[model samples]
Target: EVKGDGRAEDAYLLATPYNRRVAERLAGAELRLDEPPPPAAATALPNIFALYEENIGAITPLIADELKDAEERYPPQWIEAAFREAVSLNKRSWRYIHSILRRWEAEGPDYEEAGRDPEADWLERRYARGKRGAGRLR
Candidate 1:
């Protein structure tokens, strides 16, 4: 039996744990189980959009949509690291950053920069003309 008499006790009861269920029961409502809250890690992640805006350039609506898609497809840490890598490489294009994310997804990330330029390799593969042409497009 609840001790509330529709006065301060009622207010106190509403303020306490289990009070919501007690009030609902008093009102002749069915008991419903509470859903668990989201994980702490989810809340603790840094806002990738904010990080991008700060480190990269301003986001257009198209870029915003792409960012949303990337956020869903990639981990927050990967996105942050991609941004940092783009800045370090002085390649400030979203296409460049997005390519990094895609390569990381496909080939797994290389944590050690170690004098390796994956971007250069990717670009060479993408635009390499012919053996005779070398750097020139066929």
Candidate 2:
């Protein structure tokens, strides 16, 4: 049964065999699935750990260490994008995601088919160049 606050307590979760397993997993994760993601520039995306668990698999110790290392080096949005790109490519491993992020960092993101308008980009660059040139004496 749920509490008056409509929240399920450990007692309720532990009462069921399946829910007991879920409770144990949650305890191991140290993160609540119901809690909002930590504040970041991109708040719309799901929490990184939850997203990984849902899309990939349970976060083993080695994987958790890798995630922490990646978090230190990459922005949350880059991580999210890498995950998306991996899933799109049907390569759902963290290694694939890491490689995507590394490639983006070293070579820049490939904007082709990423919902960008090449004409608009060219125009923007042209406008910027015009502004810069206007300030110089020809």
Best by lDDT: 1
lDDT by residue for model 1 (1-138), tens: 323333222223645658777666666433222436656764565677786788776989999999899999998888888887887767788888899899999999874557777567656775676555567665
lDDT of 2 by residue, 22-68 (tens): 76666534334376786777447666787789789999999998888
- Candidate 1 yields a Cα-based lDDT of 0.73
How far in Å is the alpha carbon of 28 misplaced in model 2? 48
lDDT minimum window of 10 residues, candidate 1: 2-11
Off by over 4 Å in 1: 1-43, 112-138
lDDT (C-alpha, whole model) for all candidates: 0.73, 0.71
What is candidate 2's CA lDDT for residue 14? 41
TM-score of each: 0.51, 0.49
- Error of model 1, residue 46, in angstroms: 2.7
For model 2, the stretches where C-alpha displacement exceeds 4 angstroms are: 1-44, 111-138
